[model samples]
Target: MYENKISARQLRRMIFIETFGAGALSIPAFACYKEQNGFWSLIFYGVFLAGTIAFFIIFSGKISEENFENRKIGKTGLARNVNINVSKMQTRLKSINFPEVLPQPIKFVYMIRFFINAVALFYFFGKTIQTVYMPESSFLFIIFPAAILLCYSLYTTLQKRARFLEIIFPWIITTYFIAVILSFIGIEKAMQIGNAGELWQGILSDNIFRSMGNGYLMLLCSSPIEFLLFLRPAAEERGTETKNRKVEDKNNKEGKNNREGKDDKAIRDIITAVAGAILCNVLFCFLSVRTLGPTLTSQSEWPVIKMMQLIRMPGGFLERFDILPIIFWILCMMAVLSGYLYYGWSIFQTRSGGCLKNFLGITFVCLVLLTCVVEKHTLLWTFYLKYKAFVDFPLSLILPLVVWLFKRQKDFNYQEKT
Candidate 1:
């Protein structure tokens, strides 16, 4: 029964893996380049504090239809909310209502932004892979495996894919941390950890806009609302930690109020995931200055890689091993690609009523590949994202309003019926 399903912890890790993907590698340089030593404070503020608010805003819409709780994962790559309480079919139908004017426009806007996100991420990820791991390999060769993994994640069980991320992601992070420490410790003689004051001075200036933007993008990229698409409430016979709260407070108890436990758990998981992203970004930013100093960090091609190359392993039998951060980066970039592709495919399926299927999946991947091959330059793709950046702001701000309206209507009807 749980074949294609993941536990709450796994879902949280998936968000972490997704959030830390493309941005973590590059954001540090952007942060340091923009704010230097003071980048640390901005990372905390923009990515963590603001990000948590964004997650809550999106989730506060309250999407629990316990009467329609059908967690079955069937063929055709669709897991739907089967309305088993057919006697209340009218209310269930009412609950799913769309705004009179926003239905088509909403779907269109969502797809366009989602498409732009997928394309930019895919191209950059593939380009980064080539630049780092296999410089000699053809561009198509670098992207092929990533495309395959993305397709599998989309067409197959997301739970299985999420579980895989849950298991291996920790090790990848550990490896990254070890590499960073080794790089810093080995370069202690050359390191100049001072001049962080300038970063602090610049924090409030217009100069910090790029740093803030980088942090916000890191948070935005792995938004928690998408979690709703795959969510089926955690099975609670006795309820876990939340049950303790339930058993502790009898006076607070009301009919079906226990459902709120899942809501709390979801919020906790989102906080955990966003915290991880914040840490990774901070560490990467610190890695730049801690190794290369503030001034030098701004002038490098990939400053993070430069920091990594400082690691000098001492050994007799192994001789002196060299640095290899490309492995970690390649893995991260691949994760970013999968995250975008999976999110886009999920929304497409929901909107198309599963008609797109694998055909939609194949076409999307091909478009990315074709574009990369044709353009032959990653900078153009980055420029495209900047040009179309307006697509994302409205999605984040507008969709939450829609969900809020939906919830308001839902509660009014429920109160009238009760």
Candidate 2:
């Protein structure tokens, strides 16, 4: 067992299954739940959950099987030989510590990641406490210190980490799935008496944008791409050791046309990343729609517990549990903060060229926290005006400019060589 380890393709499939498990179920289902009837909503969400799990299994299996068959000459060697090599590789990989190629300044990105992770996560924790415990716990006072502690613990644990995700990722996703199922049930019950209209009215009448806290939710799209980009500068260095080697663009046969095609593919990938960001914006819009009722109530300091009091589930040892609201809020916060940290690290790793990295991460985190804190304190009319000028405008406008500038630089370098 120790000698014969899975290949990189298998690892990637595992990562996808691990990363996307609970998240896939919750996002689309929760977004559209209010738009459909309770019985139908339950069925719709059920299908969504089933579809996601199926996709994971089928996709992962296909990739793993493909890797198994497309074995390099070395892969098809004697089983004993392959096992010995596998054991050696596994031992070597285990002995590795921090990514050696990463520069020291980039480590600061880890710090910023932790900081943003703390703020987004703890802020929501405050709201959760609002639901279960007291709302007046000066959540920051509680959460800030907690963030520091968690970060320190995280640093130590990560240094010693080995196959942590292989175990934890599946569990996190499963927990997330359970939480979403519960939220769906809650949403279904809430909609039974035609309460959707009331929530919609509150959203329209109240400040839903501020409640959702800027377009930070939309940053979810960029989060994945940001990591991909971080992976990019390193990709040109990785050779074919990682997965998807078979899909690599041919460089040896390069002619003018092939070179242009490669450039075009790079351009296309960047555009795809940008397009993903836009799709996330749309998804966040849906999430904003779902959240209208909850945010408005939270802003008014209305007991979130009371709002959820009508929601109940039955049929299990945990059926009497009414903690779905807290779960949704916490998971949402966890996803957002974890995303911020992941992207913040990517940006940090890439931006070691200047203080620009620090500026971007700090600005992003500050805006996210401010949007949430102020929403709870003020009305929608005033907050929307502020949010539009500050948050939404920068992401929509400034982010494009950054991409455009990078593309232009690449074009100029190509022209100079020609």
Which candidate tops TM-score? 1
lDDT of 1 at 371: 56
Q: In angstroms, how far off is 38's CA in candidate 1?
A: 4.0
Give the alpha-carbon lDDT of every model.
0.57, 0.37
Compose the digit string of candidate 2's lDDT tens values, residues 280-371.
Answer: 32332333235333333224332233434444656434643335434544443444344344445434544555334355445455645553
Clashes of each: 0, 0
**Where does model 2 exceed 4 Å of error?**
1-125, 149-169, 179-239, 242-320, 328-332, 345-390, 393-401, 414-418
| Candidate that scores best on lDDT | 1
Assess the local accuracy of residue 36 in candidate 1 as a C-alpha lDDT between 0 and 100: 50
Give one digit per residue, the lDDT tens place, for model 1 in 154-260: 67555566667777787778767776667666667766565657554545553555555655544454443344434433322223434434443232344246547
The estimated TM-scores of all candidates read 0.74, 0.43
